[model samples]
Target chain A: EDKVVQSPLSLVVHEGDTVTLNCSYEVTNFRSLLWYKQEKKAPTFLFMLTSSGIEKKSGRLSSILDKKELSSILNITATQTGDSAIYLCAVDPSSNTGNQFYFGTGTSLTVIP
Target chain B: EPEVTQTPSHQVTQMGQEVILRCVPISNHLYFYWYRQILGQKVEFLVSFYNNEISEKSEIFDDQFSVERPDGSNFTLKIRSTKLEDSAMYFCASSALPQGYRQPQHFGDGTRLSIL
Candidate 1:
């Protein structure tokens, strides 16, 4: 069965702390991996990683994919109260059936001031 | 800076009643998708539509659920008979057509469906 799993179901960190969230998956055909931040309502797009080794970065957040290991990690530096939200990891698999996205349960991060 | 939009932020319905959740995907997007997240649960994909047809659907999208692109701008998901288990936050998402790579999906605020 194809599934995506995220580690550290929940995390607590102080402001200015650095944290790393992990995502691992097992699928038939891997296309890409994406990260999202869900605050109160909708989930906003964060990062999308498709290749291995190379890192994708934006401001204080960065992510990388390891295709050989079938895993990915999201790193957040200079964490703030605003960064406290459920971080979701999703994997898109190329299939003859259709285009679908499989999501992890998400890592709930609480940054305390 | 276009985003997907959903109607009726919240809806309350009795079990066995029919309900239609509507969404207007980004104007230039070609791929549309529907997902649901039950309270305290992870988000789950329900279906994917492209070219006015369902290209993929999960097991949860069974006979009770159906999706339609009634017009150029509107995509709707209809529940034939709502059940208590159907209560969830339904999210509509869309993405531009992939050109050699996958495009990231953008989601709406979501419609909160409550079944009594």
Candidate 2:
């Protein structure tokens, strides 16, 4: 089975603190790794990482994939209260049948202002 | 920006009753998907559709569940007989390509299905 594991299921930090969320996965044929921020009822798209070493970033949110280690890390710098939400990690594997994506339980982040 | 859309933000149905969850994917996207997230559980893939046929489905998508694109703009998931455990948030997603190689899928807000 394809499995994606996220660490520190829940975290609390001050507004200015920097946070790092970890994701590790085991798949048959890895294709891409994606990050999502879910607030309220819907999950919004964040970043999608396909290659190792190269980091994908959007403002204060940045993510990098390490294929050699079968892991990825999402870093939030200078966090704010608005950044508080459940961060989801998903793994996309090469499937001839179709595109199959597997998700981790997710890391709940609470940034106190 | 174009996005996938779902109807009936919340639906409450009794066990053994049938339910249909609807979604309208992005007009230009070629592939569509259905996923569910149970309370306090990980979001799981249910099925993927392309070329008017089911391209892939997970174990959770059993005989009781079916999907159809009866019209050009709508994708629906039908549950023949809902069970108490069938309650969850169903999300619809779409991507520009069938394989979704490098294309990121856009997801709808999702429908909350509650089976009593």
Over the stretch A23-51, how does candidate 1's per-residue lDDT look in tens digits? 99999888888999999989999988888
Model 1: per-residue Cα lDDT over B1-116, one tens digit each: 89999998999999999999999999999989999999999999999899989988999999999999999999999999999999999999998875235678999999999999
- Place model 1 in a CAPRI quality band: medium
The DockQ assigned to candidate 2 is 0.70
Clashes of 1: 0
C-alpha lDDT (0 to 100) for residue B104 of candidate 1: 89
lDDT, candidate 1, at A54: 92
What tens digits encode model 2's per-residue C-alpha lDDT throughout A1-113? 78999998999999999999999999998889999999877678899998999999899999999999999999999999999999999889986466868999999999998
Q: Model 2 Cα displacement at A22 (Å)?
A: 0.4
Regions of model 1 farther than 4 Å from truth: none
RMSD of each: 1.1, 1.0
Which prediction has the highest lDDT against the true structure?
1
In model 1, the Cα lDDT at residue B22 comes to: 97
Poorest lDDT segment (10 consecutive residues) of candidate 2 chain A: A92-101
